[model samples]
Target: MKRTTLAIALAVLAWTAWDTGADPIRLGRGIPWLLDFVRRMLPPDLRVLPAALVGALKTVEIALLGTAMAAALALPLGFLSARNVASPAVFHPARVALNFFRSIDTLVYALVFVAAVGLGPFPGVLAVVAYTTTSLAKLYSEAIEGIDRGPVDAITATGATRLQILRYGVLPQVLPLFLSYVLYRLETNIRAATILGFVGAGGIGFYLQTYLRMIDYRAASTVLLVTVVMVMVVDAVSSRLRARLI
Candidate 1:
């Protein structure tokens, strides 16, 4: 089994090298230019610091709004998708829809929304929502399905309504897991929200692209620095929150 696994890994590596047109000789020749580019980006322009700060705030806002919207919508859809909570007829169709949403990349959703709404943070928010909704729904349904069937069966035997069963039996079991999923997704959306601006979805990424295009390497470097710091801060805070919750 180990030999078979090693053979498959080697075959995959060879296919990747062939498909990507990777050339070690070309990379070796490009090293000097790469070093030169990094050299130019140093001593990042402090003049753009204020603008970068504003862009960072905007990125956080987009992520927060997107995550909130996705969580709100996912709650009902997730319940409907859970086999324990929903019949096959309801859950099967719901699962199909969730799969369809999951198949599309968030950036592609951003492009469509940008074209429809004509740009701004709104499109970025919508894109993240569309992608996160499906992801959270799938996660939440699995959590629901994994709950102790004993409580669910006992609750049902008590002549409890479906809603009551959900409240007393299923929700208590799954809420913590659901909260953890939301926190993790918030961290992910923060990073995703940064790039949505590239397609005019609105964020610091637009400024990054602009500075690079104008050969303003110092300003671009400042933006890159701010982006990195923002992501680090968010990740640290979310990690703490997740630890406490779990």
Candidate 2:
């Protein structure tokens, strides 16, 4: 049975690869052109540095504000979605709503908000907020539900109110994991916000797209460099903060 299953898996993989036009020959033919393209992006034009800085900063701002807003909104809603805290009636509906939020792509949200707001970081931030809220809400609910029930039970035995049980018992246990999840999402959102500009939602992506359209590879390379550095720094900092938190 295992051998048959393995054969089926291999056959499916081969079929999928063939169907997708995953041609190794075509890829081999493109190597030199890829090298030439990289050559064209050489030396990273410093002239675009100031503009790149501004765009990168804007991207960071969008991600930061969006993540913060999402975290705030998700906090209370998370309790409503938790199986332990809320009744099955509320839990199912809340889970469905969060699932709805998660089902849509981040870019879709950005595009919709961009159309509504007429383009800018505002739309990008809104997109981030919308995407992140459901994501974090779901994670937060799972964390809440998975927490040690002993603390809750102990608190309840002392005649603690629901609010008191949550505050004194639940929050303390889940706070670290919740904060860690938020930071991880913050890292992801920042990277995503950079490309939000591709749709004019705002960020370094605007400048990157502009350079690409002009075929000004050096300028594009500069933007790429700035983006890479910004992402690396943010990731490092967030990782450290999360390590301490969790």
Candidate 3:
């Protein structure tokens, strides 16, 4: 049986490789171009520090606002989607809704919001909120499912309603995990907001895009460097906070 299973797995892998058009030669052609691009990016310019700093702050604001909005909306939706909280009849539909939202990328969300909001930090914030909500809701629901049931059962035995049980039993167990997830999402949103600016959603990415359009590699390099540093700082802080919470 073990040998048969191994043969089947190898056969499936080989078939998938062929089906996906996994050609080593085609992949190798991109390496030279990538190397040339990296070579040009070396010794990043720092002359545009002042402008970069301003843009970096805008990006941070967009990310923070967006993540906060997402958390507020997701906290409730997460409970609705959790298997432990939701009835079986509702669970499938709720899960499907969450999955549908998660399927869309933040960049795509930014594009839609940009059209609707007419290009600004507002649109960028909305985009981040959409993406972050889907992510947090799914993760939060999973965390809920993973929690111990004893507390919930005990609360129910006391004649507590579902909402009461959730408030008294479920929330206490999941709050730390939820907070950790929120911090992680905020870190991710910072990077996403930077990219959204390229679409005129407003952030440091806008400056980077403007410089690139004018072929001002030095200015673009400065913006990129500042953006990277900002993201690194936010990520470090978020990681520490998440560690403390979880």
Candidate 4:
């Protein structure tokens, strides 16, 4: 077994090296450029407090409203997409639709929404809704698929309809997990919302782009710092809450 494992490892290493054409000396020469880039990001500015705070608040609002809308829509779609509730023939189309939505990133979605809606926070919210629906639907469907079958079987054996089995047997087991996924998606949407502003969808990224264009590194640094702090706080809270749910 040990020899077989070592042989497999060596084969993988050889294949990777050949496929990527990786060279140790070339990588060594690139290290200094990477270090220089890192060194240039030091000593963030603190002077643009007012603008940063306002931008941060806008970002939070966009995330909150977008997430709420996604949760509302996704809850119903999730049920329809789950195999336990819908037969394979019925759920397959829903799965395909969800996958199609999820395949596009939020940035790309923002661009499309901006074109249709003519830009603003509305576009950002729509982008979030689109991406979050895809994500939550996929997650909730998987949760439903993994549920214990005994309760559903028992419910059906009692002459309950498929919808009744889902309502009584499946939803209870998956609600906490679904909620946890929503919170996680909310945290992700907050970060995406910041970038949506770059496309004129409205958020801190709009101000960040403005400062960058004007060569105001100090103001840009303040924006970056505040955004980092907000993301950290959100991630921490979501992590704690998800831990409790799990």
Candidate 5:
């Protein structure tokens, strides 16, 4: 069975590569042009440093605010969706709603909000909030459901109210995981916010798109570098915090 499965997977991969016109010969031919393009991006014109930094800051702000808003909204939704916390009636519907939210791409949300709210970082924030809420809520629900039932049973045995039980039992067990997930999502949202800016949702992506359109690879490279640095810093910090929490 394993051999058959592996053969099937390889066949599908080959078919996909062929269908997509991923010719190795074509790739080899493009190497020179690719190298030339890379050469053009060398020494990334630092003249755009100030503007790129500002955009990087704006991207961070959008992600932070959006993640905060999503956490606020997702917490209650998560509790409601958790099988151990909410009734089956509530759980099923809430899960369905989360599924619906997860189905739509974040870029689609950004575009829709840009139309609704007009162009700015606000639309990016809204898009991130919508996308992150669904994602975080689903993750939080799973965390809540997977927690140790020992404390939960003890609390329930004490005749504690549902809210009290959640506070005393559930929150303690899941808060670390919740924070880890939020931090991870924040990292993801930063990248997403940058992309959303291409659609005028407002972020470093605006500058990136502008520079690219004008064939200013130097300026575009600066923005890309700033984005990479910002994401790396956040990831490092979040990783440390998660380690401590766990």
Candidate 6:
């Protein structure tokens, strides 16, 4: 059985390699081009620093707002999707909706919103909100489902209302986990928001794309540096928050 499993895995790997065109020889041959690209990007244009900084700030704004909105929307949806909190009929369709949303990539959401709203940070914010809503809802539901039922039953025995039972029982158990998940998703949304600008959704990515298209490697590097710094700062802050909450 082990041998058969290994053979199947090997076959899948081989097929993946071929399908993806993972050519070691091609990569080796591209070394010079890669080096040239890097060399051209050196000594980034400081002139663009101001613009890059603004773009970076926008990216963070989009990500932060997206995470906040998504968390708000996900809270009730999470309850609906939780097996213990909701009946099978309610949870089944809820789970299916979440699965459908989660299946679509964040970039795809950005594209749709961009088309609807016409290019800007608005679309990026919308994209992050839409994608993170489903992702966080699923996580929140799983957290809710995994919580101990002791407190729930105890509350019910006291003839507590549904809201009271959740408040006294479930909230205490899952609040920390849910907050941690929100922080983690905030970190992820920051990264996704940065790239949303590539499609005109707005942020450093748009400037980066513009510079790259214009062959202004130094300007592109400046934008990229700003993006990295912004991401690092957010990650550090988010880590601290999660540590405190968790």
lDDT (Cα, 0-100) at 30 in candidate 3: 85
Q: Clash totals for all models, in order?
A: 0, 0, 0, 0, 0, 0
Per-residue lDDT tens digits for candidate 2, residues 160-230, read 99899999989999999999999999999989999999999999999999999999999999999999999
lDDT of 4 by residue, 109-158 (tens): 99999999886788988888888888888898899888999888888899
Query: How accurate locally, in lDDT, is each candidate?
Result: 0.93, 0.95, 0.90, 0.87, 0.93, 0.94
**What would you estimate as the lDDT of candidate 1?**
0.93
Q: Candidates' TM-scores?
A: 0.94, 0.97, 0.85, 0.82, 0.95, 0.96
Q: Compose the digit string of candidate 6's lDDT tens values, residues 163-227.
A: 99999989999999999999999999999988898999998888999999999999999999988
Candidate 3 C-alpha lDDT tens digits along 1-246? 999999999999999999999888988998998787666655566777798899999999999999999998998889889887888888789899989989999999999999997988999999999989989999999999999999989999999987899999899999999999999899889988898888999999999999889877777888998998999999999999888885
- Which one is best on lDDT? 2
Off by over 4 Å in 1: 1-12
The better-scoring model by lDDT among 1 and 6 is: 6
- Clash-forming residue pairs, model 1: none
Name the better of 1 and 2 by TM-score: 2
Give me the overall lDDT of model 2: 0.95
In model 5, how large is the Cα lDDT of residue 124?
A: 92
- Clash count in backbone of candidate 4: 0
Q: Model 1: per-residue lDDT, tens digit, 172-191?
A: 98999999999999999999
Q: Report the C-alpha displacement of residue 220, candidate 4, in angstroms.
A: 0.3
- Judged by TM-score relative to the true structure, which candidate is superior, 5 or 6? 6
Cα error of candidate 4 at position 25, Å: 9.6
Residue 70 in model 6: lDDT: 96
